[model samples]
Target: MLRWLKERLAQQNEAVATAVAAADLVDKRYAAGLATYLQVLSTQNATLVEKRQLVDLQSRALSLQANLSRALGGGYRPEMTMTANAHSTVADKS
Candidate 1:
C-alpha cells in the first residue's frame, strides 16, 4: 500500500507539472496571436478540472489506506491472513 501511495503521488506530481506547462503554453500561444483568449480559457479550464480530479482521487485513496492501516493495527502482516482464517474456523465450530 505504501508503494501504491508513492506511485500515486508521483503520478499526481507529474500530471500537475504537465498541466502547468500546458497552461503556460496556452498563454504563450495566445500572446503570440496564434490562439485566442477563448482557447486559452478552454485549455486552462480543462487542466484545472483534471488537476482537481487527480487531487480528489489521491485524497480518497490515501484516506482509505490510512483507515485501513489503522484498522489493521498499523500495517499489513501477511501472516495475519492465516490467523484470521483460523479464528473464522474456530468461531464456526462454536
Candidate 2:
C-alpha cells in the first residue's frame, strides 16, 4: 500500500507538471495570436477537473498507507493481506 501510494504521488506530480507547462504556453499565446479567452478558460477548467480526481485518488491512497503504517506490528497485517488461490490445484508433491 505504501508503494502504491508513492507511485500515485509520482504520477500526480507528473500530471500537474504537464498541466503547468501547458498553462504556461497558453499564457504566452493568449493575447496576440491565439483565440479568445475561452481557450484559456477551457484549459484551466480541464486542468482543475483533472486535478480534482488525482487529488481524490491521492488522498485515498495516502490515507490507506497511513492506516497500514499505523497497523504495523499490531498483529493485524494479515487482515489486510491479499493472497491468490488461483494455482492451488497444481501443487507440487514433494
Candidate 3:
C-alpha cells in the first residue's frame, strides 16, 4: 500500500507540474489578449486543485510510512524519518 501511494504521489506531482505550466501559459495568453480572463482563472483554479491533491497524497504517504515504522518495533526512529523527509524534499526541489 505504501509503494502504491508513493507511485500515486509521483504521478500527482507530474500532474501538478503540468497544470501549473498550463496556468502560466493561459495567464500569458490572457495578457496578450489571445485568451479570455475566464480561461486564465479556470487554469489557475485547476492548478490549485492539482496542488491540493498532491499535498493530500504526500500527507497520506507520510502517515503510512510512520505507522509502518512504528509497527516494525522501533527499528526506525522518528528522527530518522524527519531527516529522510527533509532530504527528499531538498532533492525534489532540485
Candidate 4:
C-alpha cells in the first residue's frame, strides 16, 4: 500500500508539472495574441486546481505512510507481534 501511494503521488506530481507547463504555454500564446486572455486565465486556474489536488494527495500519502509505520511498530520485527500479545495476555491476568 505504501508503494502504491508513492506511485500515485509520483503520477500526481507529473500531472501537476504538465498542468503548469500547459498554463505557461497558454500565457505565451495569449501574449502573442494567438489565444484569448480568458483562455490563458482558464488554463492558469486549471493549473492551480491541479496543484491543490496534488498537495492534498501528497498529504494523504504522507499520513498513510505514517499510519503504516505506527501499525508496524515503527518497523516490523519478527518478534514484535508475539511480544505484544504476550504483554497483553499478562496484563489481562491482573
Candidate 5:
C-alpha cells in the first residue's frame, strides 16, 4: 500500500505540474485578450485543486511510511517526524 501510494503521489506531482503550466498559459492568454478572465480563474482554481490533492497524497504516503516503520520495529526517526510536520505545514499553507 505504501508503494502504491508513493506511485500515486509521483503521478499526482506530475499532474500538478501540468496543471500549473496550463494555468500559466491561460493567464498569458487572458493578458493577450485571447482568453476570458473566467478561463484564467478556472485554470488557476484547477491548479490549486491539483496541488491540494498532491499534498494530500504526500501526507498519506508519509503516514503509511511511518506506520510501516513502526510495524517493522524500526521506529520513527526525528527527521521523519520533522518531514511529516513540514508536509503538514505546506498543506496548511496551501
Candidate 6:
C-alpha cells in the first residue's frame, strides 16, 4: 500500500505540474486570444481537487496498513490508523 501511494503521489505531482503549466498558458492566452479567465480558473480548480483527492487516498491507505500491522501482532508501523479505535472497541481492553 505504501508503494502504491508513493507511485500514485508521484503521478499526481506530475499531473499537478502539468495542470499548473496549462493554467499559465491559459492565463497568457487570455490576454491575447479566445481563452477566458473562467476557463483557466475551472481547470485550476479541477486539478486542485484531483491533487487533494490523491492526498486523502494516501492517508486512508496508510491508516489501513497500520491497523493491519497491529491486528497481526506486528510493530506499530510508526504510522496512525483510522480503524484502530473501532477495532479496539470491539475487542477487550487490557
CA lDDT of each candidate?
A: 0.83, 0.71, 0.88, 0.85, 0.87, 0.77
**Rank order by TM-score, top first?**
3, 5, 4, 1, 2, 6
**Residue 13 deviation, candidate 6, in Å?**
1.6
Candidate 2 overall Cα lDDT vs. reference?
Answer: 0.71
Candidates in order, TM-scores: namely 0.61, 0.60, 0.74, 0.69, 0.72, 0.58
Query: What is the alpha-carbon lDDT for the whole of candidate 1?
Result: 0.83
Which rank order by lDDT, best down to worst?
A: 3, 5, 4, 1, 6, 2
Higher-ranked by TM-score: 3 or 5: 3
lDDT (tens digit, per residue) of candidate 1 on 35-81: 99998998899789778978887887778777887898886555687
lDDT tens digits, residues 1-67, model 2? 5677678778887887788778767877896667568878877876887688688987897678567
lDDT (Cα, 0-100) at 53 in candidate 1? 73
Worst 10 residues of 5 by lDDT: 72-81
Cα-based RMSD of the predictions, in order? 7.2, 7.5, 10.7, 7.5, 12.7, 9.0
Supply every candidate's count of residue pairs whose N, Cα or C atoms clash at under 3 angstroms: 0, 0, 0, 0, 0, 0
lDDT per residue, candidate 6, 7-91, as tens digits? 8778877887887788778878888877988998887897788778777877887788788788878776444455776688778
* Pairs of colliding residues, candidate 2: none
Candidate 3: stretches off by over 4 Å: 75-94
Off by over 4 Å in 5: 74-94
* Candidate with maximal TM-score: 3
Candidate 5's TM-score reads: 0.72
Local accuracy of candidate 4 as per-residue lDDT tens digits, 1-94:
4677779878888988999999999889988989998999899899999899888988897777678779876885445769988999999999
Identify the superior model by lDDT, candidate 1 or candidate 4.
4
lDDT of 5 by residue, 1-94 (tens): 5567868988998999999999999989988999999999899999999999998988887887788788868876656778989999999999
